[model samples]
Target: MAAPIYKVAIVGRANVGKSTLFNRLISEKKAIISDIAGTTRDRNYAVCHWRDLEFYLIDTGGMGEKSKDIINQQVSTQAIQAMAEADLILFVVDVRVGATTEDRILAKSVNRHKTPKILVINKVDNNRWRQNNDDFYRLGLENQALVSAANGVGTGDLLDQVVTALKKIKKKKSKKNGEENIRTIKVSVVGRPNVGKSSLINTILGEPRLIVSDQPHTTRDSQEIIITHNKNKIILVDTAGIRRCSKKSGDDFEKMAVEQSLENVWRSDITILVTDVSEPLTWQDKHIIDEVIQQHNGLIILANKWDLVKNKDTKEYTNYYREFFGFARWAPIVFTSTVKKLKIGELLDLLVLIYQEKHRVITDNALSKLLADTIRRHKPTKGAGTKHPYIYNLKQTRTNPPEFMIKINFKAILHESYLKFIENNMRYKFGFIGVPIKIRVAKSQNLQDK
Candidate 1:
């Protein structure tokens, strides 16, 4: 029997080291760390295992202050949503700053949930700071833990407390058989700033789970959300918009946010590249596409804001993307509008299909037959000083973004264009749609076989 996945949320006001604590617990730097307040505008999710217990740890944006700004309101909403969904809450606070008005306000919100919460007094690097905890205790939480998230002081005890609190809660068992064998597909929604990446995800989810703002960089961390589509489990990652701007123009927070966004492309099994259909594809968009191809994950081009575009010719936009993103010709394109909710259902269906395609494996006998037929149609060209290079064998070495190995007489003599030609034929015979195909060439001595 499989155990239920518990959820633990870390909540607090801005700059209280909540993200630092989150990183310390997850044992990875998934969240972008910054001294700037509001650096984390979205709720970041990651799995954490402690004392043989596995549960999800959610890092949420700062709440309180009750600002009238649209972004602040949305950030608060996201945090509240995390609190509502979490089974446990870690109310992190700064020891140096003590408890402020915002802390008191957030305390009330965290208290209303009836969920178990622990008041974590962070930044207690030394005994002097650790001795003073009266102000924090005033917040009225029965449980508290003092730890230095930066120096790894007392974090073990904090985790122990977390385990103890979680043990008290009961978990329900799932009745589905073979649930353990079902693989979760991680799909990352990535694109340039203000291009409706968050909006697109929100439209698909049927709720505003992320903070959608007109301002760029509203999403600084890669927020993960799990959803089931056609009985397939998928982890949707909403990443921050990437920009190719200089350091002087961008801050450290933005730089790290971009780095985290790109890292999601590598971590996910599939990537949905959101583009602004209203404007022509920019160099930055092309750069992002290149990154996805380099990672060799399944790719889906989502041309967003289709309602704003003057020309609605699907064929025109399809050909335009093919011309600009020629490097990723295998990737499928879906023109969608968040406002009109066009093609939202189709996008999810396509995602499941792409996941299946990425994991599809072709048999060696079929591959060998394809190679023989392909070579008959067009023989491999000769090198500068050599006769026609004879092909020996073709075999797929791996799947999940299928990789193939070619046994040739002289690997160096084989041109990349020919390798691409072989890949095209392979795709023609077998469908590897929405996923990148890798071909590896190796020298073989079986020239007489061909």
Candidate 2:
């Protein structure tokens, strides 16, 4: 049985090192850490285990009451939402700067929730700042701890206290949940800026768990959200929109955001490429597709904003994408509109199916037959004076984006077209929909053994 996941949110004003403390607690650099104010714009969640306790540690954006910027307001709203859901809140503050109005505002917001909280006085690495930490108690939370998240001082004691609090919360609930050992399917939603990637996720979740805006790159960090459907736990990762690679670019945060977004593709089991249906596909969209295919991730192409198109011909759009993205033609495409709530359920069903296909395994007997039929249908043409590759046997070596190994005659070369033919035949014989298959060729030591 899995222990119920209790949310412990780390909230503070801008540049208080909440993200740094979050990384220290989880022991993983899952959240982007920067000195820039409000580097974190969304709530980032990661599983944290301390001693005998396990819970989700949520890192939220800095809250400020004075910022009138729309994005800043959205950031504060996201932090408030995190506080509302958290079972325990860590109200982080910088001891050096003491408690300011921003900290007071965030503290008031955190207190609004009946949730239990601990005031974390951060950056007290030396005695000078440590002695003056009494001002933080003015926020009115009784429980408090002092630590420097940058150098990892006093963090272990802080976590010990956290574990104690979490234990109480766990005992009070006393809920025995099942499916602790169930594997989580990771699906990364990626696309160009303002293409509705986060909106698509919000639609599927049936709530605004993520911040949505007309502005590009609203989602800076790749946020992981866990949802259960039909007994399957799926982690949908909402990634930052990737811009065209150029020497001239956005700030360091945006650059890091793009790098992390691409990195999610490599880490996820499936990658859902969301494109704006109202506009023509650009090189950036194809660039993301290539990355997904290269990573061998189960793929689903989503055509977003279907309501805006005059010609709602799904087939036409599919054909156009297939022609342009010929390399990734195996990917399944779904048309979605967050505003109209189109195909939201269908997308979920397809996601589950694609995840299953990624792990589909074929027996060697079936693979041998597939190889024989492929060769008989379209044999490799013999090159002038050079022997063509003679493939004798084929077998699946791995699953989850299935990989096959082919044994060919030594001192012979196989054309790329022949490999394509084998891949095509494999797909036709066995359904490997929405999954990329890897075919590796190995030269046989003996040529005439067969």
Candidate 3:
């Protein structure tokens, strides 16, 4: 059995470079970083390994400032929750700014948790900034380290200390073998403002895990919840509604929320795009679909608020959207009402099916035969002043968003229509429903020799 993963939370006031440190530590730009304060309003989590020690790293929204706004309050609540759940907290502070009043308040909150913590003085890129690190010692934390998250200075020393501290916590492995074997499927609920994304998650959860309101942009952060249904573990991420920059009121917070929402789409295994059934498919909906396809993630077009649409011909609506979203014709569409809790269970069942299809593996023999038959049925047309395109061999290179490699002659003359035909035939034969497949074309060595 594998050892338990330690939970490490990066907590601090706004604009303290917590997200930068998180990206540096995880070695991935999972968290959106910006010069704007409160860029991160939700808890971003990722698993990081160092010297055989695997730990769950959580980059939380900035805290310490008191705000009467509902969104700001929720962000603070999420950060507090992350700190509480963490086995070890890295209380990040800016060395250049020194410790402000908010830092003191944040420190007190951290002390209340009584969890083992390390004082991380960030942005000590030079000797001048390093001198200011002494000011943070007054926070009364013994274990501390100075590092520059952006420049990668002194991070090794900080990680070494982190390893030493984590070694103290006893490992608690899962006893249930079946539970250990269960793979969690991450599904992000995404759409435009006030599309009932949070409400859908709450209804599906059978509880109000996320704060839902009628007000647009009520959910400023991406919140994640885990549930097990019929022996399958699923992680549901309720994200902020993405709005166009032109329509935006020029608020920095809203801009960051939009960026975070887009980031969540890439992070998830499947993206469920929720749209209001009453409204026609808007440009924002199409934009979200383009983002999902760009990320090569599984997609589901959810027509939410179905209960509100009166005397609507479901078939017409379906047909319209099917034609409107012809580019994403492979995505499954489901009509649901979070208010009525309609088709909520069916959505989960569909997710499981999509998850299986995304991970579906096809052998080289099967792919070779399918490609041969597909090319025979629809031969490639000759390009202007170029030889006819011929695919000599085909094989799947990877799965979980399957990718294929096709050895071809005259790759330059391979038209987009022919490639689309190949993809369509592959999907028809393999049933890659709700999954995007990538095909890479390469010059065949044997064809080049001939």
lDDT of 3 by residue, 1-450 (tens): 343468899999999999999999989776767887767776777877787677888888789678997767877887888888898999999988899988988898898887899999999899988776777878888899999999899888888888888988886754666677887899999999998999998899897556666777777657677788778889998888887877647776678778878888889999999999988888889999999999989999999999989966889888988999989999999998998999988999989999999999999899979987987798876455467776778888889889998776754467777878889999999899999989887776474433
Give a tens-digit lDDT track for model 1, residues 227-312. 88877788889988998978577588778888888888999999999999999899998999889989988999999899998878
Model 2 stretches with alpha carbons more than 4 Å out? 1-4, 66-68, 170-181, 383-385, 445-449
Candidate with maximal lDDT: 1
Ordered list by TM-score, greatest first: 2, 1, 3
Q: What local distance difference test score does each model get?
A: 0.87, 0.87, 0.85
Backbone clashes (count) for model 1: 0
List the candidates' TM-scores in order.
0.92, 0.93, 0.73
lDDT of 3 at 404: 91
Q: How many residue pairs clash in each candidate at the backbone level?
A: 0, 0, 0
The 10 consecutive residues of candidate 3 with the worst lDDT sum are 441-450
Per-residue lDDT value at 277 in model 1: 91
lDDT of 1 at 121: 94
lDDT of 1: 0.87
The reply for model 1, stretches above 4 Å from the true place, is: 1-4, 174-176, 410-412
- Which model is ahead, 1 or 3, in terms of TM-score? 1
Cα shift from native, residue 388, model 3 (Å) = 17
The lowest-lDDT stretch of 10 consecutive residues in candidate 1 is 381-390
